[model samples]
Target: VLVCLILRLSGNVGAAPESALITSLPGFSGAFPSKHYSGYVTIDGKPSPKNLFYYFVSSERNPQLDPVVLWLNGGPGCSSFDGFVYEHGPFNFEVGNSTGTLPVLHLNPYSWSKVSSVIYLDSPAGVGFSYSENTSNYVNGDFQTASDTHTFLLKWFELFPEFVANPFYIAGESYAGIYVPTLASDVALGTKTGAKPIINFKGYMVGNGVSDPKFDGNALVPFAHGMALISDSMFEEAEAACNGNYHEPKDQKCSNILDEIDEALSGLNIYDILEPCFYGSAAKDDERKNTSSLPLSFKQLGATDKPFPVRKRIFGRAWPFHAPVRDGIVPSWPELVKRSGLSVPCMDNTLATIWLNNEAVRKAIHASPEAGEWTLCIDIAYTHDAGSMIKYHLNLTAQGYRALIF
Candidate 1:
């Protein structure tokens, strides 16, 4: 019945309120060479817009027609259904700590949906199950999340009008690297399609992106000594005391590189300083039997608490949370802003939740007047190594996009 209520709310859908739940998932039968669907996408007039859950894989026995990607995950309140059930998905979720039946994981031949048609969006407006009976329009930024993802891709290309001129792309990672280049430059500048062209945007991808918070603290002192998580003489004395300054005195070389990366990451264990390198391309006995039959660290991914005292009580009034509150002596920002009367301005809520003062992302797309042409890829070795892993390849070349950086 409605695909058993969308595979039982796609396995226990949390963060509730999809208009008091009713999924309706049926319709995936037969000569199956691809055809999947699950619903919800209702967002008209901002006030109480909810019901935005989606899944629509399609190939219907390929004839070379795919390319649709659109994913977004960054916790400007997280949930791109964990990039479709855990990175490059094709279905994955097997949690049942006290059960007798769990297995349901499928497809993984480098599953970027076997060549694209992904979508997975649970966005701006109280995240998962996407609500918003006006929780103050879910306090969004980045131009109301690129105008509610351009009205959810013009009602998902008016409910799949045979892929309305397919060739779309928009991937994500780390605050979706500022939500896929500000919603792929507002869906490649198309908003009033009365003259046709609502979207065919064929370019965008981001991984480990936080695109220029002034080069994100210029790659945290060489990615804290190439992920050994600090040392190499405290990343060469915080790269010679924040060398050519990074705006604002940044409180003395960010307080001596947060006191020598908190004395070399005290009690060293941010899941052994962020694991996941499952034997870079396998083989030491098949990467120790696939990191001992997976559950690859970061305290098996549940992240065994104490993430720097919960990011020092959630970014204790920034300035990079004053070196984890002066290495845990806590209380500083003008003595916790005169003992929590909370007079805001922690650099205007960290530059308006990282939209970094969005005047359409502070101009400069070569000063857009619909600045047609554009191309730029700043990789600096995955922006100074966090065990470097950035591989991009943009298309549409003849003078619009041609990015590439290994």
Candidate 2:
């Protein structure tokens, strides 16, 4: 979501870290309109370090004055680059003829960076290019993720203090529905508690976010019924069986009805119901084969848990979607995959997987060679400690922090 560019001249106090500056990108030959910087910010140093990676694109309109927005993509385990590559990032990628080739990049006319500088971050250790020397840090939840991201912001500001006074905003889609508001609350608290490099925290935005388990879980039936994806009789039966509480069905009959409804809607694209499902093709076999070492969420979301040629499955089964646990941890991605053994029948991440894994691309972006493979989503033993984000939203909004839900 690219908003209208707002100008606000502010004083810059420190020099931007030169080492983090991106001189060039591998696939795109055109000159960048504004400065770009990327590198790791050590969230926890030494003995067992936790390093978070970020790619910062300065606002083309005014790097010095435009708002700085931190963008996140939610899977509890997903990468923000999902936004950077496919959504509102500055570049639009053209998939190569073969999966092994680097994607061609062109300037995106509707890039959010046109209006504001955007930081595409990989948060929580073990996601995307972010990593931890000690594997134990990989098991984290909402609180630690928010806290680490806040720390990233503080250290990031220290490296590029010029933007410290700029009006700062947080934006994300999907599961970031949880990430944005919670992180906003933390940033607001940081400013009030006299945290260093006081950011001019402004507001936040969430797109198709998940806030409460009860509300989110119950939304599917009505939404499906309204969309005409399910039958009148089926909807009536589900309503009667579940007593309008889809999140927690009282009996096996309701659960069975719900399963029937899922079967009815299974053929449609969960992300975009209008789109036809993509049955696996020979060209995609290579991409599918590359999944063994990749994160389970990507495979599960793509619905590739079992062997190829599986039916297109809905995202409802994936994490962040399974968000209404209210308490306890969502099953790890591999566990979910093992149980379902289904593939995402429509979604294809071939380009992102290929382009990102390229040695040239990694080097160009300042990603460590040792960072291993890149994955859109990773497997994390995440505990839903934040429970319902309703309180966080109410708290932040009450404090005058603007919030947008789309």
Candidate 3:
């Protein structure tokens, strides 16, 4: 559910031993073999006023020998706990019969922490329990975030300085596509300039990410077209009307075509494109029943002129207006809906949200007194700086960093 870029370290590092240990975690039925640590590290910004919260999990196998991975969830504002709970963390929220109380946690078999020691960080000062005593720091940008996060790594090592010499990797998903490389660039450059607590920075691991805003936006139409989600006419109209630009279409028709694309995909769980959500992870029964209540276009909202396709039989049950038209046509009238009704398979960030907002959970994680609520993503007023990461990737490769995208 998260787009990630991994910075894989190639060699070993040497550091003095120290004790930064985890006593226990709530909800695990038994003892955990690995140590866990959660705390806040004050970053050097505004001459002083800031902190970034983190959850560090040591490998179950070999903590000393295993490389350290700094995993970041990209929302430019989202909490890394989303990654911790949903993606690759050591534990996850349990299934619920209802959304009435705090969700319990369960150990994960496929956690990345099973092999490598991982640090899940809430970054950019304003995310998760990370905060700034001076609110002005909340309005940040790519370099500013990287700069502070780099300082955070240095200071974090000061706390568990034993791992300072461990191979360090930076991985981020989504906007962290923006965040990861930017941070990697900072670490690489800082090391070159002889920055203190020298980090054994390594390479990148990511899926295709947003490198160039323009290309990222422009590529959507072609991708949708390739997927047969949009009509050729719609694609042609989008290309012609906006002059091959859809990021912020100036022409009205292009906007209409873009809206059509949205309408086509509205019924799908974008993260897991194969599934149509019968109910959102957090949606109650009444909410599930109200899936049909979402407003639609005049034609889709109103009655249609085309004759209904012949109903099909499944186990002798006649099913009419079934979902998922092969021609990429709109869903049946009953299937017409919006985001609230959607849920991704094997993903429930909503569950993470429910758990983190609990008072006890915050206390357990040593959450900041300043941060009011824990959320999957944060919407901060970050200044957009890098238009693309092409230059950054080229630079890293030139500096001898290997790159992998899955």
Identify the leading candidate in terms of TM-score. Answer: 2
Q: Which lDDT tens digits does candidate 3 get at residues 1-406?
A: 0111121252334332233345655555677768888888876667458878888998888887677999887656777886787678887566455544555667888899888889999988878878877877787888788888888888877677556666778886766778888889988988889887677777766643557776777777787788776688877877887787776678678777777776665444333333333322344564344333222221143332221110000001011111110111212122221323431122224466667777766777777668877765555666657657889989999989977755
Model 3 gets an lDDT of 0.64
Better of 2 and 3 by TM-score: 2
What do the candidate models score in CA lDDT, each in turn? 0.46, 0.76, 0.64
The deviation in Å at residue 336 for candidate 1 is: 45
Every model: Cα RMSD to truth: 20.9, 6.4, 10.7
* TM-score pick, better of 1 and 2: 2
- In model 3, the runs with Cα more than 4 Å from the true position are 1-20, 96-98, 248-250, 278-348
What TM-score fits each model? 0.30, 0.85, 0.78
Top candidate by lDDT = 2
How high a TM-score does candidate 1 get?
0.30
Give lDDT tens digits, candidate 2, residues 274-316: 5333433433655444333322323345433322212221223
